[model samples]
Structure formats: structure tokens, C-alpha cells
Target: MIIVALDPPQNVDVEKWIKIRYDELKEYVQGFKIGVPAIIRVGLEGLSKIFKDYSGLLIADLKLADIGDVMALTASIVGDYGFNAVIAHAFVGYSQAVDELSKTCEKKGLKLILVVSMSHRGSEEFIDKHLESFVEIAKRVGSWGLVAPATRPLIIKRVRELIGSEVKILSPGIGVQGAEPGTAICYGADYEIVGRAITHSENVKQSALKIIENQKQRVAKCRG
Candidate 1:
């Protein structure tokens, strides 16, 4: 599945732009990822309005890393905004914050996707070292999915091996971040979170279609 990360520019009409993107690519991609930039620009209430009729998966990339109480409240807010799922940080540890987020997400009918590892260079400094621990936390909390980086296919492969198939993996860092389309899926990711590539393209629908086709070819080759 290809999940478009809608990080619109602060100067444009965030809601309208999101709606346009959604309408254009909804048929091709499986879902949308709303990151902090868009949320901060339009707020959750605005998101509620924009996605009021959207039936596809809507994920709030909040990356919640606060205390248990705060995380729970945030998850509730995201749910109230009509988000289907939410992303949280797994480095926050297992028993408290992550656990509360998981429970709250479940109560609110939202899938909790934890960020086990990141896609940037700095992530290698710390997050990469604790990859196993993060995976363990996700398993213990019974998280619905995990955020792995597409930039590092080996990391996605290792994460898939550790978690097996019970939990899903969502990978970012495609396109602008340098990972080719389908690179993550070829390794192990169930979904690729693409942002600028499609959003910045002149023809949104075509870019999305091209990406989907590329992913299909890669997956077929890997299986064969």
C-alpha cells in the first residue's frame, strides 16, 4: 500500500490542497499521512472538515512522545478529529507512555503505529542501536503497526524478521529522501509513506500511478 504524506506548504490553503490531493490520488494510494506541518497549519478541527467524507485510512503523524496522560489525551483528540490511526514514538519506553497510547488508540478505534526507527542520518546515532528494544515494545503493546525507514532497506528487513507478519510496517524516506519507490516494499515494508514526490509533482495522479506501478514490478521481481 502507498500512503501519501500530505505536508502542504504553510502559505497555501491547507485544507483545500489536501482535499484536492485526496481526490486525485485516493483511488491509487491506500491512505494519507497527515504530519505536524499540516496539522499545525490547519488544526485538527480543520482536518475533520477536510476529511469528513474520506473513507480511506487517515493517519495522524503526531509522533506522540509525551507522558501517558498527555499521550492518551492527544490520541483522543486525534480520534475525535476522525483519524483512523496515529503514530507514536516507541523510544518512549513500553509500560507507560506507549502502553497508554496503545490503549487509548484501541478505545478510540484508532490503530497505533509506533516509530521504531527513523529514516535520517541522525537516527543512526541512537535509534538504530535500540531497534530491537523498540520492536519488543511494539510487540508488547500489541501495536497495530511500526514506522520503519525505507532509506535503509536492511533495517526494514530486520524489523520484519523481528516482528513477523502480525504487525504492519510503514516506511518513509521515499523520493526526496532518496529511496526509490517500492524499495521498502521490496525489502519488507507493507506501506510506503511518500510526501514531496507526489505532492510536489505537476501531475499528482500520474506521479502516484507511476509509483504504484513501480512498486508492483519490484514486488513481483522479489517474489519471483
Candidate 2:
């Protein structure tokens, strides 16, 4: 799925911006992703008003790393508003409390995607240090997916090997972040989290379409 990260234009009417972007790009992409910062900027009430008519998967990138109750409550708010999934942090060691959060997410029916590694510079060492334990948390929590950085193809490959096919892998860092579009999927990603690559392009619809085309071309090349 091509998830368009919903970012509110700081100077414009955020509700209008969202509507325009979604309406324009929905046909080319599968879903939309709104991070915690964006949600906070517009508030859930504002977000609900704008997304009520959206038919695709709505992902809330909570990336929560707090205690269990806080995570549960945050997820309650996200699920209540109709988000299909939410991302969480698994860097902390597993325990009964985290298991409780897992139960809460399952009860809410929101898919839990754990962030394994980030895209920007300087995150490698930290993620590498904690990678093994994070995978353990992911397995214990019944996570639906895992976040892998497209910028690092081997990391995706390693994650695919370690976690296998049961866990869906979502990758970011395509286009503007310098990772080639579709290449992540070649390595092991199931979806690419594209943002500025499309959003900042001169033409949003065309940019979105090109992302899909790029992926398809990659697939064709691999098969050939």
C-alpha cells in the first residue's frame, strides 16, 4: 500500500489542505498516514470531520513509547476515530505491562506496527544495539507489522530473515530521503511510506502514480 503521510500545511487551513490532498491523491494510493504531531496540531475532532468520508485504511503513527496504560488510552482515542492501525515503540524490554498494552490494542482491533529502525543518520548504532530485544518484544506483543528503513536495504533483509513473512514490513525513506522507490520492496518491504517525495512534488497525483509505477517496474525487472 502507498500511504500518503498527512501533513498539515502550517500556514494554510489544515482541514482544507487535508481534503484537497486526500481527494486528489486517493485514487493513486491505498491509504493515508497521520503522525502524532499532525494529529496534535489539528486535534482529533478536527481530524474526524475531515476523514469521515475516507474509505481507505487510516493509519495513526502514534510511535508511542510510554507506559502501558498511556499506550492503551492513546490507542483508544486513535481507534475510536476509525484509524485502522497504529505504530508503537518496542525498544523497551518486554514485561507484563507491555503485554497488557498488546491486549488493549488487540481488543481495539488496531494493528500494532513496531518501529525497528529509523531513516535519518545516526540511528544505526542505537537500533543495532537494541535490535534483538526489539524483535523479542515484537514477537511477544503479537505485532501486525514492523517499520524498516528503506535507506538500509540490508536491515530490511535482516528483519525479513529474523521475523519471517508473518510480520508485514513497512518502509520509509524513499525519494527525498534518497532511498530509491520500489527498491525497499525488492529487499523485503511490503509497503513504502512515501512523504515529501510525493507531497512536495510539483504534481501530487503524478508523483503518487509514479511511485506505484516504479514499484511495478522493479517487480517486472526482478521477474525478467
Q: What digit string (tens of lDDT, one per residue) describes model 2 on residues 84-161? A: 788887875567445666888899988888888888777676876677678778988888988889999888888888
- List candidate 1 segments past 4 Å from native: none
Colliding pairs, model 2: none
lDDT of 1 by residue, 129-160 (tens): 99999999999989999999999999999999
TM-scores for all predictions: 0.97, 0.94
With candidate 1 superimposed using the best TM-score fit, by how many Å does residue 220's alpha carbon deviate from the native?
Answer: 0.9
Single out the weakest 10-residue window by summed lDDT for candidate 1: 9-18
lDDT of each: 0.91, 0.82
TM value for model 2: 0.94
Model 1 global lDDT (CA atoms, 0 to 1): 0.91
Best model number under lDDT:
1
